[model samples]
Target: MSTQITTDRLVLRPVEASDAARIADLVNDPRVYRMVARIPANQTVAQTLAWIAGHTAGREENTKHPYAIVENGELVGVTSAHRDSTWLPFEIGYWLSPDRWGNGLMTEATEALVGWLKQRGERGFVSGYLDDNPASGRVLEKLAFMKADRIKVFCLGRGEMVGHVNMARID
Candidate 1:
């Protein structure tokens, strides 16, 4: 089941319908969309609401855990842990508003989520970063995820294939 987690400066909670507007605003930014593989650019509120509904349903079905990243009670980004059909390990992914970059918030949020998973007896979580987004690689390194492999994957948002670095933390 999805649970709420709080860090020093952020709250990681399940996505809700009310979060549609803020989520749309953050993701509609080209900077944010460019880094995310599945999210399309220029998403409208209606589209975001539909996505949130699906996310909520996914959580209920035990298919995924998609969270809203709240800072000061405002949604600024999103993070999730879910199954990957192509890979057997649980996959963790996240994205933040461009304005919030360089602040270490993603690192902090990621660590908290990893800690939560560890406490629940979960290990060997998997994730990937685009070859161009070295910053994301650093975040995985901070979590002690070792590089497992590199592969080319199509980014739906970018509408092109990009190199990806697969990472895993077995401990």
Candidate 2:
């Protein structure tokens, strides 16, 4: 399958090493970090590069697909699908620049990602959002992801475990 995907207003392409600086800047923003689970607050460019390398390895292994979300030729966010084990459904995750919120870009980007995965034979997907982030829930709901469970997961940025709502899309 092609690594590049495009929607009405965005281009979703494989995350590149060159995007490290921009990615770091976006994810390190307090607004973005608070909603995302894995990124550290005040993340450095080197750390971002390491993360990009992992995505590179994931691509080679066919175990993860991370995309750089581009709109109007600028990198605006990141989205990805990955699984810890073969039997588990691939989990979808994303975070965007706070300035871009409420614009439906996330839904558009995620829907395109899910559709791309479906075309590649991915049948089940899992995603979750912190309980405090209802906008994320709305995005998943728009994609037909049903609430599956409520659990606490560590939010590295938040520096503590937070209430999480897991959602799944099964085809």
Candidate 3:
């Protein structure tokens, strides 16, 4: 995978076709997706592959960035940011594999992505952590994202509840 940028101990690159299973397994783990509402309770590898393809392809085609975080040559997480078609500020989102928890991989990837986004002269704010996922909130806090507001039950899908928090980095 080509490098988007590398931290001292982690590599961030674009997601590849072969990475779908690894990402799928990790995402399918109950611990990771229990709080995420939009994803299915039992996501098949096929569904994951398709979802990754569509999301990553859309991002790449639009010049929006979505990076797969690699540690020791293994895909362990993801980080991304982009404006929706509505001209909103780029929404920054991320997830780290359960196996990689406590390794600082996600935090490292987030810092790299944020700094990269800023250096590219990107404008608008970056919203962070909208799914009642406090782990994400913690990372965003580390990156200096401030809470804007909260929207209860932003989406109801796949038999899950999705609350949202709006955040911004106007710097």
Candidate 4:
């Protein structure tokens, strides 16, 4: 798969080691951290660096594809696709800074990723939003993903179980 994708207003490129500090600043925001599952609420730059390193290794192994969302030459968010097992469909995930909310940038970024995956012959994907985040659900719906299930998912960032609305798109 290609390492970069661009939309009219944003560039999605592979995450790099140099992005750790910027990404840390974004994810460490309480507003952003509350909605994400994998990033800790009090995440530090060092932890963010480690996370980047792990994702880099995963990319080399073909196990994960994570991109930094850049707009106006600044990193503003992230999007990724990863799987628990090679046989399973990849799960899509994304988040954007609060300042960028309401601009439909995430919807565009996700559509680009989905299009890229389809071009590579991938036919199905799974994604979910925390129950509290209706905006995320709206984004998935805009991409034609159907709600498939509802379940409790443990959010490492929040250190608690939260309800998630699972959605899927299959060709």
Candidate 5:
């Protein structure tokens, strides 16, 4: 089952239909989309709602967790965690709204999520970031995700090749 994690100043829970519009707005922000892979150029509220439904359905079926980050009852970001012992092992991912940038909240929020996931029998989280997003790389380091590998990654949106750092946390 998907889990909910809460911190002193943040709440991390499943994304709901009510969050679709907020999510759409956050995802469409140029700064938020810049460091990631392909993001839809034009996303309607209906499309975001449908996407949330699909994502939640898939999470329910697969036992993964996707969380909407909220502060003061306002959505500010999203995070996801998946376990695949067959191939990729455990992984976590997230994107923060530009408005909340530079707060180090991502690192704090991530540590809370990692501790929560570990309590639920999860460990050895593995994740990476496109090199262009050095902030993400810095977060990995701050969170003690050890360097494991590197590879050239493609960004469909940026239409260029970028490097990525493979990292893992096992404590």
Candidate 6:
């Protein structure tokens, strides 16, 4: 079974199949979608379910770990870490409901996720945020992720390559 983690004010649970509709509703918001690299804008419930379907296999293979952010029993966001190659550091990413921004929730959730990974003996991690999204950069900074460099990345929601600020942390 997938692991569930709890924090003082949040619960980090394995993403469930039943969460597809809520996930779709969250990611479909342009405020959330435009900031996340992979999520398409206006995603459908079917698409979100298809994405959630991979979490189990990903967890088993250790290629990806995605968690649903829950506050007061309500699902609010998603955070994950993944690496394309074993030699590469896991790249952490997240998207929260716009209503939850500016509350330091992402920072808290991500810090817990990183701690969990470190407990599993994983150390190095990399993350990036759209250059335009300073709030996300702040979340990484608060977690001791230093600015590594800048690069251009393709954002599915924007339909174009955009400036991205890469950050890294070695626990």
* Cα misplacement distance, residue 89 of candidate 4 (Å): 0.5
lDDT of 1 by residue, 143-167 (tens): 8999999999888778899999999
> Candidate 4's residue-wise lDDT over 1-171, tens digit each?
447899999899998889988998998888898898777888888898888787776676556788999999999999988876667787999999999999999999989988877787778899999999999999999999999999998887889999999999997
lDDT of 6 by residue, 60-106 (tens): 77778899999999999998888876677889999999999889899
Query: Alpha carbon lDDT of residue 113, candidate 6?
Result: 92
As a whole number from 0 to 100, the lDDT of residue 56 in candidate 6 is: 71
Q: What is the TM-score of each candidate against the true structure?
A: 0.91, 0.97, 0.84, 0.95, 0.87, 0.96
* Model 2 poorest ten-residue lDDT run: 54-63
What CA RMSD would you report for each candidate?
Answer: 2.1, 1.1, 2.7, 1.3, 2.2, 1.1
Candidates by TM-score, descending order: 2, 6, 4, 1, 5, 3
Candidate 1 residue-wise lDDT at 21: 87
Model 2 Cα shift for residue 97 (angstroms): 0.5
**Candidate 1 runs further than 4 Å off:** 84-87
Ranking by lDDT: 2, 6, 4, 1, 5, 3
Better of 4 and 6 by lDDT: 6
lDDT of 4 at 80: 89
Off by over 4 Å in 6: none
Identify the runs in model 2 with alpha carbons over 4 angstroms from their true place. none
Single out the weakest 10-residue window by summed lDDT for candidate 4. Answer: 54-63
Tell me the tens digit of each residue's lDDT in model 2 across 43-134.
Answer: 99999988888778778766788999999999999889998665778899999999999999999999999999889888999999999999
Model 3: per-residue lDDT, tens digit, 52-159?
677665564444577888888888877876565635567777778887787777888888987877776666656655465787788778888888887765332335
Number of the top lDDT candidate: 2
Candidate 2 overall lDDT versus native: 0.92
- Taking all chains together, the TM-score of candidate 6 against the true structure is 0.96
lDDT of 2 at 151: 96
Q: TM-score of the candidate numbered 5?
A: 0.87
